[model samples]
Target: MKTVILRSQALQGATASDLSAAVQYLIGVDGGGTGTRVRLSDRDGVLLGQGESGPSALGQGAEQAWRHIQQAVQAAAAQAGLGELDLSRCAIGLGLSGTGVEAQVEAFSALQPGYALVALDNDGFTTLLGAHGGEPGAVVAAGTGTIGEGLRRNGERAYISGWGWVCGDEGSGAWLGLKAMRHAQQALDGRAEAGALARAVWAVAGQDRATILAWCAAAGQHGYASLAPLVFDHAPNDPVAAGFVADAVSELERLAHALDPQAELPLALCGSIALRLSSEFSGTIRARCVSPRGDSAEGALHLVRSALQR
Candidate 1:
């Protein structure tokens, strides 16, 4: 019996023609801390189906993540008119949040799914691939959590922020919400000036200190992000919200600037809040921003095809 060395041997050495003949389907997954989506296509890249499910981000339980992915795959197959989908005939590509962490990456690599082959990478890379259509450019992902990613013509890659909800991910939904909560707390204590945004946060998070504190203990990134919309809605008339937006824009600028220090490369603003925040960019980033060519799922598929062809 031979012991399989997956760490060194996975996703290596398969000819294009060989894989093309052996593989009947391709599945691309875009997974984040909040949700997971799956897109299915045939060997030739014609779209077949798509599906979405719960969160599959890293650090979450591996079984939970795989389970949601499996469910999403099944949903896609059903939408593709297949009553019975065989995983062994399908190849998969996944771009997942938190996979940048070495331990998280290693944990996922150890898994043996029934797919013919699998390619896994951090979600930001796929975001960059999708935004730029595989070209050399950068993307500032402003969503539940923010991150900046880029690829140079020479294949040099860079990532900034995305340190998660607590300390980093500046200008992200969670960041805004966290700031809003802080303002709300301060308002209650009379320690800082409160405005319409802070008042709104108080209404949503409960009016009392004890109640707000309890909610904070139970709240996660999503909960924090849910408050961002309120802040955005009130930003026009609310000084506090306006301040939050200003800070967020500056942080995003920092992220984009780090990738293209000279602010020369084409940049795309992506994720849930990209368009909303785009108008706030103060520097060259505003002009450098380009529309995304596709999305993360498409990039995942593209990566799969690229790998197979290699």
Candidate 2:
């Protein structure tokens, strides 16, 4: 069996041994629009295994999220050499996307699988918890979606962005992809120059107006997000792609500013898009960014541990 090692500082000094003896396992789940990732550990915080599965974003559906989470948990159990996990003997913590919606949260919580204990929060908050090891700081996570959260010294918390892809989540992969599609549409109409970005988007979205319309009809958040890599790949040579990257960087910077207007809290950039665009950030913001101590999954573990202590 493969052994997993997590960042030591984040996992140190937090022994879940004091939890109920019946709680033999600690499972941390980080679920987003892109996928669900699970980190399995013994109660004592020893890493056991890690597993990943398809999207578990609550916006996708509460039932679908649970199914994906269960699949990931089972995979983690198998990787740990455990035949099957006993939910009743485990405590689970989840950091998931779309937890901002009260109805979705309620729906997902209603389906809890009999775990001994549970703690849940949006992925942005969990990312903040992990980035700072539960300290006062801020994080802007830009992946399939985008969110900014900050913890102040007075125990106050602030959230910025994270409005989801339909109307918000600027600087996200899906947002980038949406912008790329717009560029392609304009190019196809001859309203804009047909550059490399337009050509690439057309290749995936279809070359003709009818086919493009058909593609857009079915291109949900995830489908549109699938085109984000093209933007990144062409940014080096394509002005349109480069402009999108510039806009994304600015959007993320705005999130940081909104999260901590005073800019006092340490800031950590999380998620694939955030990391990829980090270097492109303005010098001031770049200087303020710090590497995260852990990730959302680890923060979920911390969440349940705190819950158990209370």
Candidate closest to the true structure, highest lDDT: 2
**Local distance difference test scores for all models:** 0.81, 0.87
TM-score, model 1 to reference = 0.91
What would the per-residue lDDT of candidate 1 be over residues 153-194, giving only the tens digit for each residue? 787888788898888889999899999999889989998777
Once model 1 is optimally superposed onto the true structure by TM-score, how far is the C-alpha of residue 40 displaced, in angstroms?
Answer: 0.9
Q: After superposition, how far is residue 308 of candidate 2 from its true place, in Å?
A: 0.9
Model 2 lDDT tens row, 141-176: 999999998889998888889899989999999999
What TM-score, computed on C-alpha atoms, does each candidate reach? Answer: 0.91, 0.92
**What's model 2's overall lDDT?**
0.87
Clashing pairs in 2: none
| lDDT against true structure, model 1 | 0.81
Give each model's clash number.
Answer: 0, 0
